[model samples]
Target chain A: MILPSAIALGREFAGARFQIAPVRGLSVQDGLVIGSVLVLIACYLLPLGAVVALSFLVPVPGIGNYWSIFQNATVHAVVGKTLWISSLTVGLTLLLGYITAYALVQAGPVARKLMLAGVLLPLWISVLVRNYAWIALLSPGGIVNSILIRWGWLDQPVSLVRNSFGVVLGMVHYMLPYAILPIYAQMARIDSTLPHLARSLGASPRQAFIRVFLPLSRPGLAAAAFLTSIMSLGFYLTPAMLGGGKTVMVAEFISIQVTETLRWDIATTLSTLLLLVTGALVWRFSHLLELATAKPKT
Target chain B: MSDFTYDTGYMQHLEQSVRRETQGKTVHRRRFLQVLSALGVSIGSLSFLPSARAQQSELVVANWGGDALPAQRDILAAEFVKRYPQIHVAFDTTGPTPGKIKALVESDNVSWDVADRNLLSALELGRQGLLEKVDESIVDINAVPSQFRTEWGVGSYFFSFVITYDAVRFGSTPPRTWKDFWDLQTFKGKRALRNNVEGVLESALLADGVAPDKLYPLNVNRGLDKVRQIKAETIFYSNTSEAQQLLRSGEVSIGSLWSTRAQGVKEDTKGRIDYHFNEGILLIAAWNVLKGAKNVKDAWRWVALSQDPYLQVALLKKLGWGPINPAANKLVPAELQAQNPGSPENIARQIVVDAEWYARNYFEVQNRYLDVLAA
Candidate 1:
């Protein structure tokens, strides 16, 4: 209605045969937009190009580096550790984030706003600060261990820092907010009436949640999982700080090669591998990204 | 910029350690002469020979940039410029050189004239033909110590991995050896060990009572099992900075730590931590000149200047490291000198890590260790 009214008003004011030509507008405006996009493309292309070039040059290629990655039990072990931590963090973040987002929508508006702010507080803090906070919070004399020991749950302070479990906990906590925000945005657009209707049709609330809302939230869940997993995959500092050099992640392993061990080909090759894996995940979920940004229900 | 008055103070400063290593070489030669004399060998049979390779002045040396050694290089460069004004000295410091050497050598992109490499790094570079044949013209023939006179290596600095315990907590009855460290039941609280396999392995082997000379061809299985035994109790630190932080917070009661790192903590803690060298991990920092060197003469000059005892002592005191120069001993305070890696008591007590054996098994053992940790 608004478009037709505006078109008629435009014809009266300008010319009798005015037409809204989006194609013309897009093409003309594309000069600036396309140019900006090309500039951004160059920015991304430069790093990717260097990485592609490096993997081939170092170790004389012919899949020697990749073969080493496969054959070398140590490198594979580190990569495996990285995969384990990243996948676990991603899974837990998605489940917890979706539940929290759903709960936020169900809560009172004022309470929802406060809780959402609390959820986001971790996200806004620097990753390093969060890592240090984890150190203090989870260390033997730190708050958590102190409480646990006081409650007779643990006889002595367990070795928490520099272990895989602490590393995953810290990573999941850091990635939680990133997961929650996207899921919340998706769930916020989900109309409450649909779930109410499901409950009215003899389905219990859990059934209504699982059958009605969960299916609708799948796209967001995919996107949140994708983002969280990718972020966790390259986590060097968290694992280094919390893993205590015991649970070496791929990023940390690669860094040790470059900085301490001085194995550039292996480091660069591993980084290239990390890039490929991350790209594969993004490509696999490209459709979910589309769904995530799809037009909100009319 | 070309004519600035450079400070050769660090290079010109080593007197203590340079003298010590030189004395050992001197003693070896003298003992050899004494043996020859005891056999009634005639000195008249030998004729004095002319030294032909005395004219080279310029050399290039490279190492990991911004560590304790570069300051010595700077001083050495200045000293070399003053001594051999005709010989131009250029130095480059880079990060660890395993991949760099491999890539640089294979591609014929070799830039380093001389490399101050870790033991393993040197072995790898030398194996790849990246290291140059070390000519001993500049080195004092009779004064060159054990590894310095090697076919492929020059002795640089010697440092230690000492057992530093919380002095405030264990003032009198501090843990002395690897056995004491392994006994966590007595040590009390948590224990920290180097996450790097070297110290962990060394401690295990030492506790096993393997002779220092035979530690090479390491018993890796034994080391890993020893590691596994303490895996639950040991807080392994890979990040160098974390060791000191762990000590400060009392998270670790005792730890096997780099001497310099342990000393760094003592500065803040006001000697709250005690470093004992009874079962120290002694290491030699070596300078290996690449075979395809850009500046061979400069590398030699850097090595010669590094051999200066004044510079050795100055760098060690300033950096909490040990010097190759025997003369460095005089510069260190008599009390602190007792703890220095170059000191007689400390040197005799510690075992020199065998680089050759480590070079052979590093790749395999590291993988195995990683698997064990993961498992």
Candidate 2:
């Protein structure tokens, strides 16, 4: 079954490629494409190559850096913590974003425009400002605590913006738009009357949503999860500010090694590892998405 | 009328010449190529001219920017420029973290002539051969205390990590020693500590009853154990401003903060936030010239100028950084003496940070410190 679907996906991709193939030989457009590829190689790949080379060459060369990092329990702990936080952020962002995107799809034209503006407006603000805003709202003496205490919810202000919870809160707030836009785009492409068709076929509302709408939006859910998790993996400032130095993430740990400890070998080695893992994850996710979308007609 | 006709005739002549030039396709293309090449050459040379000129007279002094930028510019750089009008001083305030200094020196593009860093950085970078030795003949090394002077760097200023607490919260029974700081049951408030291991270990050791003099070659495990004692009720602040904010906002009623930031917070809160100098970990901020600095002589001149007793006093007045020069001690008024970290009275009470021990063990110890915090 999997083989048949994979073949179908390969055939679909080949058909799409042929559909958009250029007609003629080298032209100005071809030259521009070649030039941009060369520029990308110079700008992006060369620096990445240098970083990988430095990881091996520094601290007397060989795989000593990698060997030490692998044995270092701190690196393992930091990597685990980073993965845990990224997964948490991805899950929260998807749940909230899916709800918002669904509302957007069902709302009136004017309401949709206003909701979109609300979502996209935050994206325009600087990330630093957003993180700081979360701090102001969730700190011990902040507005949330103030309100909770005034209502006699508790005697003491709860710890909010200085732990894993705060880091995830800030990250989810920042990642909401990223999650919403992709899911909303996918939802918009989905036929609105499909659920109605399912209902006419004697399906309950919940059943219709589960069987028809959820499967259709799976690609968008996967896209959102992939984007938020990838972004969360690299987050530095949110975790730094919100975690209050307790919740050490990979990016912050790498920065410490590079700047404070002067351990470039360790820093570059961790970076190279992160790059390889992310590359593998990206490849796997893309393949999974392709398989999910491919259908072998009976 | 004659001028207008001449301009029109010249325009007509130029148009006719362009038409003549374009009459031959090959010549037109060749002329275009020549103009493009000339434009590229002139623009490229123009970009190089200013950099070449700057290299002759400019000396960059890198320091952590904030309130220090304006103070250093108005005082130290201004004095240096006044003495030697031939040399101009510029400030690179991106901070001179040791890693940055190493990268700059190794890349063979050392931009900073003199960097304002800590004693540990000076010793570490000097050991790695990233810094130029201080020219004794140019800089008066004896101006500062012997402990603060090094072959590759000289004392820039003195600061300390002191216990800063909310005066309103503690009132008359304020926390004094690190022991009091660790007494969470009595203090009854959240505490803040520096995220880095530099002064944190000293504070922890002092809290654990280690004598000031015996704090060298720190007992890393013991210090971390003491830190873990209060880790549940503590917040580790990464930067000085965060430490101040933690105190000012009452997020943490007490924090171990830099003397300079503690002072700022005290004044900002109108004395509601106060710091104690007792058991303060005194650390020296130093000036080191990069190994391949473009203006070595000018850099030495800047360092020498910074050491002048009067200039150091002036900096003390503007910023609360204690003057490194002992002579500047006498110049500090009685009113500001209590505020000065290097004052005779304050110095007597505080423990000077063991720079040598940190220079060797900082990386390993800091990793452990971070581990304890994260754990």
Candidate achieving the largest DockQ: 2
Range of the 10 consecutive residues with the lowest summed lDDT in candidate 1 chain B: B46-55
Instruction: Give the residue spans of candidate 2 off by over 4 A.
Output: A1-39, A200-202, A287-298, B1-53
RMSD score of candidate 1 (Å): 15.8
Candidate 1, B1-375: lDDT as tens digits: 233243655433343224322221121222233334655866443212111112244454555454445665566667777887787654555443455554444433345566666655567567757676666787653344665345566776777788888988887888988888888788886778766676678888877677777877788888788878777777778655677888888888888888867777888799997787787988777777766555665676677677787877766766666766666666777866765787878888888777777666665576566567655
Error of 1 at B270 (Å): 1.8
| Model 2 residue B59 distance off true place after TM-score fit, in angstroms | 1.1
Judge candidate 2 against the unseen true structure and give its global Cα lDDT, from 0 to 1. 0.83
DockQ for each candidate? Answer: 0.15, 0.26
Query: Where does candidate 2 chain B have its weakest 10-residue lDDT segment?
Result: B45-54
Per-model TM values vs. the true structure: 0.77, 0.85
Docking quality band of candidate 1, CAPRI definitions? incorrect
How far off is residue A95 in model 2, in Å? 1.5
B-chain TM-scores per prediction? 0.74, 0.85
| lDDT for A220 (candidate 1) | 86
